[model samples]
Target: MRTIALHTQTSEQIGLVLENNDVIEYVSTRPEVRTLSGSIYLGKVSHINKAIQAAFIDIGEERTGFLKKESVPWAQTSIEGTLKEGQSITVQVTKEPSGTKGAQLSADITVPGFFVIYQPYGKRTAVSKRVDAEQAEELKTWTSQQLGKDEGVIVRTAASKVSTQTILNEINQLRDLWTRHIKANTTDRSHKLFDDPILPDQLIRKHPLPLIKEIVVNNSKLGQWIKQRYPILAEKVKWVKSVSTYTGISINELQSKLIQPVVVTEQGMELVIERTEAMTVIDINSHKFKQKSLSSYQKLEMNKAAAAEVAKQIQLRNISGIIFVDFISMQEKKQEKDLQKYMSGLVRKDPVSTTILGITRLGLMEITRHRRFSNVSEELSAKQKPTFSKDTLIYRLERYLTENTQSEAVLVAISSDLYNHKKQLLSNSISSKIPQELFVRHDASIIDWQIELEGSLDMIQTVISERVYHVDNLF
Candidate 1:
């Protein structure tokens, strides 16, 4: 069982509540700030790079916003010809800027709430994927009647069991908000027209229902806002004086736990997640329970348990991209099938799309999940510098050059901080390994390096073959 506590703060007061480790809620006295996630802006195109197929927009920021050609509303117009420099166009931000990448913008705009998603550009009504056929049809019909043909809306998963009155209230609120934004747009050209508010309902809309037991907020105003918008959830809401008091833990302790290494266990097996990456690799090892007396069937059961745990880990960590799971091999085909079945069931619970390919010939299971935001490891390592040393970079470069035999080669060193370090080592390492006969000049400003070997095509092929072989051996 899990308990939830809520904490809120006004200009003068703070409140908190604590349930179990599973649930805690808090609020702040800070004024509500707008997030760019779903806000629509009329931006002016500042620059366009046809080579990169990207454009920069002046969205009232120091750095111009970025909009890739694909992200533009292609259905609306032929963007290649329609978009021009200094032209004003309606756009929405999909992702905030991080690092050197500018904020990601889209011509398509969507305002998602707990019970419905409002699409300013859409003409047809759609239903959430979680809703059943009956509820979807009914909701679609009701939304059409209430909203008319002026705008489009997608009924959310939370509306699965909601009443018509609740749906109507949401529609009215959204319509009013949209109207206000439209009015503001006519008068304001250099400021935000409609930035999304950080409301409790907005948070609940973003997360999956099964994972969120409850929400707790400390501010009476926020608490009232939640209860007014989601009367059904009012009973589950708890208010407290402060977030720290609500969680029964200090802010520092909460941060530590959130940032700590995650440990997963199932049956007699355990796996520790020290770090995560675009390609998450899980190394599995048997823990205790060596079956000397038991049959092969008993051993197979442990492998199945491990597979199940891997699936759970993927969801809990919100891991995506190429995942390599090294599972304990079972000789029997039946055992492998059972493990696969168990893994499939776990994947079904995940909100993100997932595909579980069976074990590779190399005895590795490959799983892929769709990625939206950065994975758990990236979020945690935001402050830490990379650990790759100068020695390691040199060793990698030398191995690459020795194994691949080709006419010309390009080595792109991406990171700004590592460019100089990589360039110096690469030039010296290649000169030492292949002798001065190879021409190598280090250019610091060049983001990438191209190696061209002037010789017979066959000789070029030989160099590439050798370099590739050497690089593979180093890894």
Candidate 2:
């Protein structure tokens, strides 16, 4: 069974997709680095690069959006012929802004519903290939009749469970959503038209119902909203005061593991995953395999086991674009073929478009995964590893004082920003974390923060009383 866990933390909202109690995917959203994917915009054509066959558009975002000539579904000519410098057009964001680059936009607009994706400029109606062959053909014919020649609908796997009436209802709702945003011959300035940023609902829509044990969220309002929108989920949607308390999963521990580059498998193999601007690299080392010696077949088995871990890491990290994996070298061509087939089968399980380009001449496995959002590392600021806030430090200090130094209290020297807070606010805020008996003394002498002294409460007080004018006792 699968469970979805949602939590709001210090700087971001986190979502976890757990399969059989293991975290399969980790996603987060931050206010500063928001995603632009699936957002529609009234954009103005800023520049058309005929050489590159692309257009730069001003969509009222921090950076301009890039729309390739091929992305314009309705266009029959070159980008220069199709777009003018001052022309206004409706576009949808297909990718987020990376580094200094702008977001990737597309003219082919698609609005997604639970069971169908409404394509306003799509050429033909279609259904997921995972659907039964006969049913896919039937849905294709039926949906083609429902949608006109210009528009189309891509039926999803979930559509098989619902009645035709429910599918049509979803189709109409998605169509209405597009029709409401797009209008005929309006000269509107460059600005945002619509933002489909409800990630929890989007995730729930993507996963089928039979696999889900329950969708637990910390926020009651969000749980209620999910229940309302997806009545099909029935009692599967639940509201809880604390997700970890109910699910027995520590989100913080999972998040911490996400930031680390090294992953050690139970097979004693380690995967060192590194992300670069150009691509991601995964180097697998089997120096410490539990088996002392391996036969050719045992080597093949090790590579296959590593392949499963690689696939899980790819999804969990949300690593996209080009990826190269350097696995333990296999000497036999037959063994290499077996490993390739095994990895291909594993990548097919990913929801996103992931393809194995087969093994290169250097025995490196080449892979490509395309996605629209920032990766787990980027969202977590794993590279930066910023210092903790004052509140976080206080919480840590309280834990330390309670756990290890129960009889002893410490004198801390913190920066003025932390030490010189408003009088009443400091007492109320800092005092609430520790017991009234445990004491804290602060001074603005140090550059950042440091623990000055630790002793029994009375000894610390005696020292402070000797140097009475030097420090301020916060509690």
Candidate 3:
């Protein structure tokens, strides 16, 4: 089953692509950490370093954006001579900010639509390589005819599946969008020109619509909006109160254990993954298998399963840069060659440019995935720790209390520390959204929040009154 599960709760939104019950790509986005990959900015050159031949740009973001010399398409001679400090420049974000680095800037701007990407700085037409050679040639000929002397349009893979007129219309639409929304902003002040971070649009840009069998979302508001906005996908959109309801998998568990060093696949194969500062390393082990000894074919199958799992994990964790994977040792060169070929083919499915550098003499499979954004470990590791702040506890408690809308009234017993924190914060904002007949019992000895009762208002109140009496009594 090919499914896109969207979990929107609290401040973060998570999107997971599941193929046959396995997660291949896991994307997490928050308002504060939103990606700027396709954003265009009207920036000013803050400073220029002659030694590094790079310029620091004020893109009206938290960090100073970095623009290298090569990224400046119109640059000539030296960086100091070509660009002046405080000069206004137009640039596109090629990569999102990772770690302490700012968004990667490029002078070459490209605006993408459903079927075509309009490039104003180009002169040649390009077709996606995934298209058949004959079809690609035809698309190239037809698309090139539509381009101007200085403009270009890349015929995306979706264009091959669509009509020539549809592609042309999209090209025009994208060009007009750029001209009106981005290019028209000729103000000298540093500001963002264009940024489209819609969740449905973001998913469509990453995964082809035809390949998506179903899209399950947790938020009812988002689910309804998607169906209303795009009636074409109304059938494919499924809304559930809980994200894990249809998948039979815990979204919270998947997220909590995502950064773990060990993972076990359904085939009884254990994968030990170590991510260091330099590279990520993975080892496949069959210690958990039931069979005491396996045949050569069985061993190969294990290795194959491991290879596929490694690819899935790589994308899910967003592991990038240098990677080394070690499968079970094989004696035959043919098996090794076959494994390499199979693994290479699997990695090709990744949206990011991931290359299989082939097997090393030490029996390590070498691969490199281009680093665009921070890995899941970098963002999730800290959050996964047991030590959560009082604010986090409040959020968790609130999520737990109101998860079941069927409950008419609910009462929860919470620790004094948590109750104090919630009271200290916006108490009205926190309490106004919950059930009308809700009661909170603050116990000094309690370390966790426990749901006391979920029933009619009279029943819940009686239960809380009894609890208060028992607490007051020494017995």
**Best candidate according to TM-score:** 2
TM-score list, all predictions: 0.64, 0.72, 0.71
How well does candidate 2 score on lDDT at residue 223?
A: 79
Worst 10 residues of 1 by lDDT: 10-19
Query: Mind giving the per-residue lDDT tens digits that candidate 1 earns over 1-475?
Result: 2343433343322222232473232222224423466667778888888777778888885567898887764434445575898887777888877667667888666766667877665567898867888888988988877765557798887777668887788777777666675434643354566665434443345554434565666767777777775565677666766656655666445444435454456465656554544577886766566555546687677767776667755654557888887777667777777777778777876557788888777777778888643354444345675665766755665666666565333333233444456556555445445422343334456443444455554564476577652221111
RMSD of 2: 12.3
**lDDT tens digits by residue: candidate 2, 133-234:** 999998888888888678978898878777888888877777766776455424567888777774676666657766778988888778787776566675
Candidate structures ordered by lDDT, highest first:
2, 3, 1
Write the residue-wise lDDT of candidate 3 on 6-78 in tens digits: 8887577777788888777777777776778878899999999999999988999988788898877567688
Better of 1 and 3 by TM-score: 3
Give the alpha-carbon lDDT of every model: 0.61, 0.79, 0.79
Ranking of predictions according to TM-score: 2, 3, 1
Alpha carbon lDDT at 371, candidate 3: 79
Off by over 4 Å in 1: 1-36, 47-55, 68-77, 80-87, 134-138, 181-188, 197-202, 207-213, 225-235, 242-268, 274-277, 290-297, 303-316, 351-355, 372-378, 381-475
User: Which runs in model 3 stand beyond 4 Å of their true positions?
Assistant: 31-34, 48-54, 74-86, 96-102, 196-200, 218-242, 288-295, 383-475
Worst 10 residues of 2 by lDDT: 418-427
